[model samples]
Target: MKVHIHVSLKSGVLDPQGRAIHHALEGLGFAGVNDVRAGRLIELDVDDSVTDAQLDEMCRKLLANMVIENYRIEKVGEKENA
Candidate 1:
């Protein structure tokens, strides 16, 4: 199974990398970008037997920082991103 973990900082958290990207965009003359928030995508190829509960645990335990980050788990069909 293919899984995508979308990890992002919680609201109100400071994102220096996102800010840098936003500034760079403006410097490149890409206007009208009011704000920018950045996040990460983690793609995993796990066995079919990996249950949803286990995946959730993986995110909670190690993939995301519960204190400052939020994560969404998406299960995708093999053909979807291929």
Candidate 2:
């Protein structure tokens, strides 16, 4: 099975990289982009037997910083839930 983990900063947390990208876009004459919140997508190929609990554990323990980041696990071909 293939999984995609989307990791991003929490709502109240500041994102310097996102800000920089926004600024760069404005500099390059692109407008109407009010905000940009950057995030990451991690793709993994795991056995079909991998349980959702194990995937969540992987995010909580190693993939994401529980302090200021949030993550969503997406298993290919299935609808995702928080």
Candidate 3:
């Protein structure tokens, strides 16, 4: 089984890195970008025995910082997961 994890900062939390990127884009003449948020993607390969609950647990335990980040799980094709 192939699982995809997207981890990102929660709203209202400070994101200095994202703000820096937004500023850099404006410096490079990129306009109309109101905001920017940075996040992470994690891909996992596992046996069919892995359940959605287990995947969520993995996110909570290590993949994402539960205090300020949220995570979403998705299933992807074998080729994409690879």
Candidate 4:
């Protein structure tokens, strides 16, 4: 099975990288960007036996820092994962 993990900062947390990008866009006079937020995407190819509970545990334990970051787990179909 293919698992896609999207990790991002929770609201109210400061994102330095996002701020930098916003600044850079303003510098370039792009002006349309009101705000910016950055996140990470991780695609994993796991065995069919891997369960949802186990995948969520993996995120909570090692993939994301639950204190500041939130993660979403998406199961991709084989056609898409391929």
Candidate 5:
């Protein structure tokens, strides 16, 4: 099975990298580029027997920093199709 974890900053967190990208976009003459927030995507291939509780634990422990970030996990393969 495959696990896809998306980690993103919570609202009100300062994102300097996202700000820089926004400025760059503006410089390139792109209009209406309101705000940019950067985040991370982590993909893991694990045994088929891995449970949802275990995956949640993995995200809380390693994939996301619970203090300033939020994460959503997606299971890939047949589970996804279903």
Candidate 6:
């Protein structure tokens, strides 16, 4: 099975890197760029037998830092479907 995880900073958090990128984009003549928020996408190929609970545990344990970021997990194709 395939797992797609998206981890992003919560609202009201400061994102210096995203701000820098937004500035750079405006410099490149990209107008109307209001804001930018950067996040991470993690893809994992695991056994089909892996449960949702297990995947959630994996995200909390290693994939995402629960302190500053929130994580959402999505299960993609199973081995047979793939």
Candidates in order have lDDT scores of 0.93, 0.92, 0.92, 0.93, 0.90, 0.89
RMSD of each: 0.9, 4.0, 1.3, 1.3, 2.8, 2.6
Q: What is the lDDT of residue 81 in candidate 3?
A: 34
lDDT of 4 at 77: 60
Per-residue lDDT for 6-70 in model 2, tens only?
Answer: 99999989999999999999999998999999998998888989999999999999999999999
Q: Write the per-residue lDDT of candidate 6 for residues 17-58, one digit (tens) a residue.
A: 899999999999999989999999988988988899999999
Query: Which runs in model 5 stand beyond 4 Å of their true positions?
Result: 78-82
Q: Taking the candidates one at a time, how many backbone clashes does each contain?
A: 0, 0, 0, 0, 0, 0
Instruction: Please write out the lDDT profile of model 1 over residues 5-75, one tens digit for every residue.
Output: 99999999999989999999999999999888898888999999999999999999999999999999999
lDDT of 1: 0.93
lDDT of 5 by residue, 3-80 (tens): 889999999999999999999999999999889999999888899899999999998998899999999998776566
lDDT of 4 by residue, 1-82 (tens): 8889999999999999999999999999897898999989999999999999999999999999999999999999688935
TM-score of each: 0.94, 0.91, 0.91, 0.90, 0.89, 0.89
Error of 4 at 46 (Å): 0.6
Report the C-alpha displacement of residue 29, candidate 1, in angstroms.
Answer: 0.2
Candidate 4 runs further than 4 Å off: none
**Residue clash pairs of candidate 6:** none
Give the least accurate 10-residue stretch of model 3, judged by summed lDDT.
73-82
